[model samples]
Structures are given as C-alpha cells and as structure tokens.
Target: MLFDKKGLDNQTLLNLYSNMLKPRLIEEKMLILLRQGKVSKWFSGIGQEAISVGVTMALKNDEYILPMHRNLGVFTTRDIPLNRLFGQWQGKASGFTKGRDRSFHFGTQDYHIVGMISHLGPQLGVADGIALANILNNKNEVTAVFTGEGGTSEGDFHEALNVASVWQLPVIFCIENNGYGLSTPTSEQYHCKDLADRGKGYGMEAFVLDGNDIIEVYTKVKKLAESIRKRPRPILIEFKTFRMRGHEEASGTKYVPEKLMAEWELKDPLISFKNYLLKEKVLTPEKDQALTIKIKEEIDVALEQANAEQPIIPDRSVELSDVYKTFEYQHIESNSKAEEIRFIDAISQGLKQSMQQHKNLVIMGQDIAEYGGVFKITEGFVKEFGKERVRNTPICESAIVEAAMGLSIAGIKSVVEMQFADFVSSGFNPIVNYLAKSHYRWNQNADVVVRMPCGGGVAAGPFHSQTNEAWFTKTPGLKVVYPAFPYDAKGLLATAINDPNPVLYFEHKALYRSIRQEVPIDYFTIPFGKASLIKEGKDVTIITYGSGVHWALETLANNEDIKADLIDLRTLQPLDTESIYNSVKKTGRAIIVQEDSLFGGIASDISALIMEDCFEFLDAPVKRVASMETPIPFINQLEQQYLAKGRFEEELKNLIAY
Candidate 1:
C-alpha cells in the first residue's frame, strides 16, 4: 500500500505529490490571506501537512474523519472544495457550515465528514459513534479522529477509547503529536512520556508513527486503519508532528522561544516530502509546478462557486421546527384512562405503545435495560424487547447521548434515559449540537427522544432531587416537556417521539410512584406547541410546567376565592404563547411558577413573554414564583429556603387584593 516512486506507477505517485503540496501552499498563501480580508484567520498546519495529507490519502475514500483545527492539511487532501474552504475562512455563506458554524466547523458530510468543534477531546466520543454506525450498517467505512496532545489529556478522550474497546467499534484514534497546546507545551497537557503508553489502559492496540516522515505516516496508518476496519476494532495511532501556527488566528506562540519555533520549522513536512519525491525520481519541479498550478486554479474556481452560493441564513421561524416530525397530530385520550394508571406506568405504557407502532425506536441508559432503569419504568420490557431495543449503556453521559444520536441519525428512534434530570448535562452536547441542528445543518433529520426523571420531592439529596428542565429551556432546536401526571407523560411522550425534532421529555421523579389514576388500554397522544388548562378561574393566570403544574393546581384548590387559571405548558419550546395570552386577557393578571431558580429559569422567559404580548391587559406587572437564586441545599432546612414553597399563594392573594 506504500506509494513509493519506485513501487507505484508514475501517475499514482504524481497524484500523491500533488496532494501533499496543496496544503503546504494553502498554508503559505493563508499568510497573505490573513493580511488581506480574504481569510480572517488560519491554523497553518505547515509542518504537519505531509502526515495529514498522506495518511488521509492512504485510507479509503468513504472513511469518516473528525479532525482537529490544526489538521487543515487533511481537509484539502481529502478534496473538500477549495473555494468553499477559502470562503469558510472568508466567513461567507457558502462556508461549510452555511456560515452558522464557526470557521473551524468546515467539514462537509458529503465528503464523509461528520463535523464537530466543542472542546478538543470531545471528537473522540463522536468518532467512536460514527464508527459504530458504520459497523452496524455493515458498511466497511472506518472513522478516524485526530487531535493534539492537549486533547489526549481530556477525560473524554479516554472515555471514547474505552467505549470503543468495550463495544469493539471501528475507529482510529489519531493523536497528532503537536509539541504544544496553545501557550502550554506538552509538559502541561499530560504526564505520559508517549501518548501510545496510555492507550493500553483502554484495551486498544497502540502504535507510534514518525509523523515528520510522509511515507512512514501513510504506510503505518493505512496498515492499522485497514486492519482495524476489516475486523472492525479500535486502534490508537500517535503521529509525532508539530503545530506550525497559533492555536487559532487569535493565539500567537509568543511564549515559544524563536529558537524553538525555528528548530521545529526545519522539519517541515511538505519540504521533507518534496525532497524525498525528487531524490526518488517520483517528481520534479516542472511536474510539481504543473500540479500546483492546476490545483490552485481549481481552488480559485471553487472560490467563485462557493462565493456565488448563498449562505444558509439562520432563522427563528423554524424555531419550533424539528421538535417532532410527524405533523399529523394524534389525539390524547386522557379522559378515558381515568381509572388505574400511575404516572410512571403511563410513561412506560406510552413508550411501549409508541415503540410498538414504530419499529426503529430504541431505548438506552444506565440500568435501563435489565433493571428497567432505577425507577422501574422500563421493567419487564427487557424480556419483551430484545437487547437492541432496550440497551444498558456505560455510565458515560457523552457516550450515552452520542450513541443515541448515532442511532437516531441511522433512522432509529433513539430514546436516551438520563438516570435523573440533573444528570442530563452528561448528554447536553448531542442534544444541542447533533440532534437539535442536524436537520438544519445537514438537511438530515435525527428523530430522538431524551427522557429523564426530573423535579424534586422525595428526599433524594441535592443531586438525586433536582428539577433541571429550566436549565435547557432556551436551547434552540430542543423541545422541553415536563409531564405532571401519567396521562400527559404517555401522550406527550408519544408526541415527542413521533415528532421529527429532538425532545427532552422531562418526567418528575416524584410523580413516578406518588399518584395513581386509571388509564385505558388505547393508543393516544397529545400535540406539542399546545398548552393544557389544568384548572380555570377568572382571577390570575398561574403559568407552570412539569411537576409545578400539580403544585400550582393544588394551591388553587386550597382557596376557592382565588380563582386561578392554571396553564400547563406541556411543551416548553413552543412556549404556547397563545395559551398564555388568552389566559392573561381573560384574567387580566399573569404569574409564572416553576421550581427551578429564579434567574435564567423558564419563569424568566414566561414573564418576558407576558410583558411583551399581554402587557396592555395586565391588571398589575407580571409576577413569578421560583426557587431562590442559589444551588439546592443539602440540608432539609436550607433546602426549604431554596425551594418554590408558597409564592403561588402569596402571588394569588396579592393579585386578587390588587
């Protein structure tokens, strides 16, 4: 598989040389681009060009890559349109991300690239997921994730490796041995002498390659990547290379002594490869120039095309788009099921029925498989649904969500259970990035339902008892729902799962076993973007959601004189403004109630909406009932102070008296 001048035909060898040169020249030209306004920034990847280009070329065409910012060479070598590449740096619409993403988010899916740019090490988990998809699809496509030594220090790097090893997924984790991470050198990023030394801990076959040598980098990677894919296992490849530019355009290696920068520059990957090609008679200056000029011309032309193409303008109209796919709203027969169902069982029955209707549905989380999750919601389901449908994943939040997103993109309806709502942060990235924007970014839909036990009531300490739904209400492309009782939980869940968009179906942990009501054995569901009137009165509109609906409604029953209109926001993303406005118009007063802290909570959003839309109708200024602006306390006495205890009553009396 080695592309040696003596070993390969002239045509093949010449192509390799050309591929190696483009990245080098692009990096060289980028200096001028920075001076002009064309490319506002650059990650030179100068000395590492040969390794990125050569190794990438060695792999099959359809293989997937999650490369770091420094691996600019790899994209060019992989043949992403050059003009689009330049336009990306130019911050134009035709940029790979349609200009919605940052300059670094340039990988195109058509080129077998699943793009990412969170922190440095997060791509490892994603790479593993992409590779897992390929394995399941029985596609011989390998996934390669590249990062710097700084990224290797990240915990996700190890988590991804371990998961890949355990699942035996086909991913090549490549560590480009860039001597430093921004200002700090390799000394600060990790203690490992060589990164390969750390791979065995994850049960991966590790190998180190001389990244400065193009032939060596290519041959070794090709060997490992092919072997890993054929058998479909994971491997760790350490490419000993260097970062030739600042981390991004903003960073300057002022700390690195000029002597050190100059010393590293001597091992420039492109120059060294060129010398090898000439010495071996693989290429001459004339042929190299012809290739370079041809590529440059093609790139210039691509620039015209990409510039001519329009940027995908980000919009708010589609703000409610993709939260669910099935447009045909199904009726929720909640009234018929008023006999024997508990909140938790309703959730289970809803999932069971919906999954039965849809064959692509899958559910996974810690203890979700055999234990039916900690709440017993998924109980007896393991026997009925096979392992593929009900899976028990390791306790890694990133992995759990990442894997679910992977399954979802492959056309499976993935439902990820976050053991508790507090733990939902584990899978936040996949929820926000992959699922939320997949439809918008790639025009590909990822139908996913992320179900978590939310809210606090049972004395499960601060971590175990938390209503974190407010934490993610503002997240675009995500529909946040909190079902108070069994009826809505099942119906709303059905609506959430069937919808094209990704949903965060928050169920109260307390409601699981607390209250029981009768539910009939019929298929039914409730629509999103619509609100439910749990109780109706003429004094004040107490807008609440999730478990808060129960508390607010209960508070209303205490004093018959306080006729509060309870608007239950079954779906949070759409905000059900019409419901809120109608109630405010009729009652002439609005008071938002939620259990999350007052600041940055759903209450804030509702209050803002009320002031903007129903301001003219207000009897008084809007009022809100929420937790104190502090973390939930560990002590019960302290916790009471932090909880949303009696604001509903106080607000009710004040508004009536007003």
Candidate 2:
C-alpha cells in the first residue's frame, strides 16, 4: 500500500488481495482435481501464497522467472494460462512440456516463465544463467529464482550465489523459509537462525521478511528489484513462513502434532490479513466476500474446464522434440588424414571451424580470449576470430561456467576454458546441476564444452596439474571426452559439439605443446560411445584413454611378444562398452589404465562393467595400472613416484611375468 510503482489505490490493493486469494482457491481446487484423478501431483503455496504473488508483482513482466514446485501463485500472477497449467499437472498434450516430462517441468516463454522444476534445488543456477543472458544481450531484466529454506543446504545454492555475486548478475534469489524441510526443521539444516545470513558468506546483500505479510513482501521485492536493475548484483531474500499443509497431498498431519497445528492455525495468513484489511476499513465485508466468492468461481470454472478436457495422447515423435539444438557429422578418408596436423593445432582448427560453422559459438574463461587460453591451446584464435567470439575472463572459475550455461540456453554454444583440471571444483555446480541436468529438466540439452587442462608431469603443483576425471565421469547426461592425439582431439571436440549432452573435454595441459600429430585437412567429427584402436594384438588388452593411451602404446612396443590390443576409450560417459568387451574377450586378459587415482576413477568403473559383462570370458584376474593413491604433488620427484601410468615399464614387466 506504501509503494507507488503501481500507484497503490484502495481498489488496487483489494485487487492484489483478490489475486492472492485466487491462488489459495486454485491450490485447493487443484488438489480436489488431483484426487478426482485429473492431475498427478500437487504442491500448494497455501499460507505462503502472498509471498509468491507479491514478489512477482514487484518484478518486471519481461524479466525471466525460475520457480520451484510451490510457485502456483507466481505463475497465476504472471498470466500463465490456467488450462496449460492444469495440462502440465495432468501431463496433457496442451502443456508446454509435451505431457511426457515430469509433473513440475512448467515453462512458457510467452509468460516469461522459464522452467519451474519441482526438485528441492537447482533453480539457482538457472536464475544466474537467465540474468547473465539478459546482461549479454543488453536487456536490463532481473531473473528471480524461487526456493525454500532447505534448498540453501545444496552445493548449488552456495556455488550459484558465489558466482552470481562475483559477476554482479541481475538475479534475485528468493527463499521461502516455511519452517520445515519435510519434517526436519531449519535448526537441523543450519546453525544460523535465518537463511538470509548465508548470502553474506558470498559477499551479496541479504534480506529477511515476514512472508505471510503481502504488503511487506511487495515493498521489499520492489526496492530490491529496482536496486538490481540499476546496479546488478545477486541478493538473497529469506521469507519466514510456515508450511501449513503436509509435504504433499498424500501425507496427513500425522507428522505434525495437533496442538502445534491449532496454535499456528490461529495465525493463518489468509484470515489474519483479511482481519487487518477489515479493521483498516480498506476491505468492506461486502467487497471482501465478493472478492473471495469471485476468485472461487474463477477457480471452479478452471477446474470444470480442466476436468472436461481429454487426457493427453502422447505422440511418440514428440518424445525426441528439442532433445538437441543442433547436430553435425563428417568422415575422413584414412589414417594418413589424421597424421598431418599437430594436436594443439588440430584443436585450434576444430575450435575455429566450429565457431565459423555456427554463428552462436562463443569461447570464454581465463586467458581464452586474448592469450588464447593459459596453455596457448586456443592460440591464434582471438586474432582470427575476434574478441567477442574468444573472450578473456577473471580468474573466477564459477563465473566462467555460469556464464556458459546461460549462453547455452540462449542458443549460444559456450566453450569454456578451465586453466587447470583440479581447479574445476570452483565451477562444479554449473557442471553437475546446471549443464548436466538442464536437458533432463527442461527437455533440452546444454551444448556447452568445458575444455579442462588436465593431468600431471609438468610438475605444476596440486592446484595446477592433475587429472580429476572421476569428478564427473559418472555424472549422467554429460559427455566426458578425453583425447590422446590431435586427430581424436579435433574429431571428438567436433562430435562433442554435435552431441546433445554437455561435455567436459579434458585437454592435457602438458600435451598442449608436446603432443604433435597431423590433423585432417577437412572438417570431420567422430562418433561418440566408440573406441579408437591404437594397436591390434590379441594376447592382452590395455584399455585406456587420453594421456595413458601413449603409455599403453609404448608398453606394447617394448614387449612386442605380449600382443596386447590398445583401445582408447575416447568418451567416458556413453562409454564404448562393446569395444572393451570385444577386446577383453578376444585377448582373454585385460588391464585398465588411467592417469587418475585408482580409487573411484575410470579404472573402477571399467572393472565393474567388465566383471558384470565379461567375467565368463576372462582367463585371469583383470588388472588395473593407475597412479598411486596420493595427491599429484608439487615436487617432480614426489609426483613421479605417484604418477604411474597404465603402461609404465615396471608395471608392464610385472603383468607379462604374471
């Protein structure tokens, strides 16, 4: 009522009160519809409806919104069609999600609502991304992300806030602290009494408010939205509310004691505000009754319409709709074609070709723009491609990745450079939660590539030199490509661009200048989930990839009589299982090799798969040759002792003797 942005009239406040009431009715009506079997799932704002609605009211219509499961009030106020909303709940064809997606994957660009995934967290990354996109496009729009107090516990929440604050992104992180995270209270989640306090840890502004009060929410959100528009920066606003209903429609108040429920019911947000309005004479009984009745009627009509609608008949073709934004394929003539270009040179050419091929391609990260990246792996690029295409960024790893995720959604292929492999933890949120799962959430893949300079022998210390493949090798919906030579680097990077999943193309910082092999003359992309044959022999199988492939090749050459078949598993996630199986069965003996720690790395994953599928064919125990279980040290002497490759001379001799 105090704000003039919408010029508060008694009637206007009454209308907002009406809008707030409608969400409650909608939530109730939808629950009834769910029991009637019209919808599959339902999560109501209930006591917290005012916050969702009021926060949205403070925001610009053009600004993007990323919401959680209980954001019906936000969507309703944003003017998202009720039928489409019901369709999403019912998994109907009329929904933007094509009916096959999850119950919470709601999106409508028409309403400026991005995707509202029901999972407890992950929207923070989305909010950061949308805001970054607006910044890049010169569009001054704030992207608001809605979450609960419990979501603050997720690593994504911390990482997103850290990066958004660093970049000064126009993102408003709104946390609805409704006292309980599925019966585990806030006290169980964190020591700080308020969730907003965590925002200060990331060096961002924080606000705490009484969520039940709509007027307060409107005032706070309006001021924050204005401040972010003028000078962009991330801020966390914690709304202290209570979850009046059960976690879901199924659970009764079995977990919540009767006395507490009754005690909280007396302070019911709806009844409390209605009384306040009546006392102030702003809401006459006649007006209040009419407004309540009017909202109930509208919801009744929507429910009736929703019930009358036919169930969605899914077209199988719609299943693959928007699986990938773009795809390309090419073939090279022969092995000689690959023998013509140097490894780093091939990568440079592939990056350039991919950039020239697609107008939406953009490369970023530390030193990638002007210096052509830290290792000069991206050399000659800034000059040939221009600064916009190849960009330099601050040492903020999280910012580089967060920016990439935003661009990927905006139809830009964001190619990021991680100066070192071990330092990627700074950007892990965008990797695991955002890029990897973005497709699964919205039915769309992020076509971004994170070029990580990995592995050791350069004696660059623990922070700068190391192979951390296990960090993401097993994460779903992500392509992990480790290229050993120039041809594979060029071909795989090109293929990774065409793949639907996000890719972490691990480039050896040591091999950036050392490894020299001729790349093909023409543009060509290799197929993923396929292994490359480095050498053909049948006595033993050395299954490896990236830097370890060279070691395996050398070991085979040193002992020619071993007749080992060296297979390079170029792609880790969609792993070339058939190739490994065939080699293991043919040789009747196998050894897994990797540059990373033996524990929990690729060797373990490969060994498990072989045991599951090829145990019957094995003649002996499958061996694993990996670096010792120690950190890649700073000193070369200590590092060398720990850096045992798959094809080390002593390991090869020991295996042969066995």
Top candidate when judged by lDDT against the true structure: 2
**How do all models score by TM-score?**
0.91, 0.78
- In angstroms, the error of model 2 at 432 is 2.8
lDDT of 2 by residue, 193-256 (tens): 7788888788999999878777788878988899889888888899888788877777655777
Compute the lDDT of residue 381 as modeled in candidate 1.
81
**Model 1: per-residue Cα lDDT at residue 504:** 86
| Model 1 agreement with the true structure over 610-637: per-residue lDDT tens digits | 8998888988988888887776776777
Rate residue 160 of model 1 by lDDT: 83
**Cα lDDT computed for each candidate against the true fold:** 0.75, 0.76
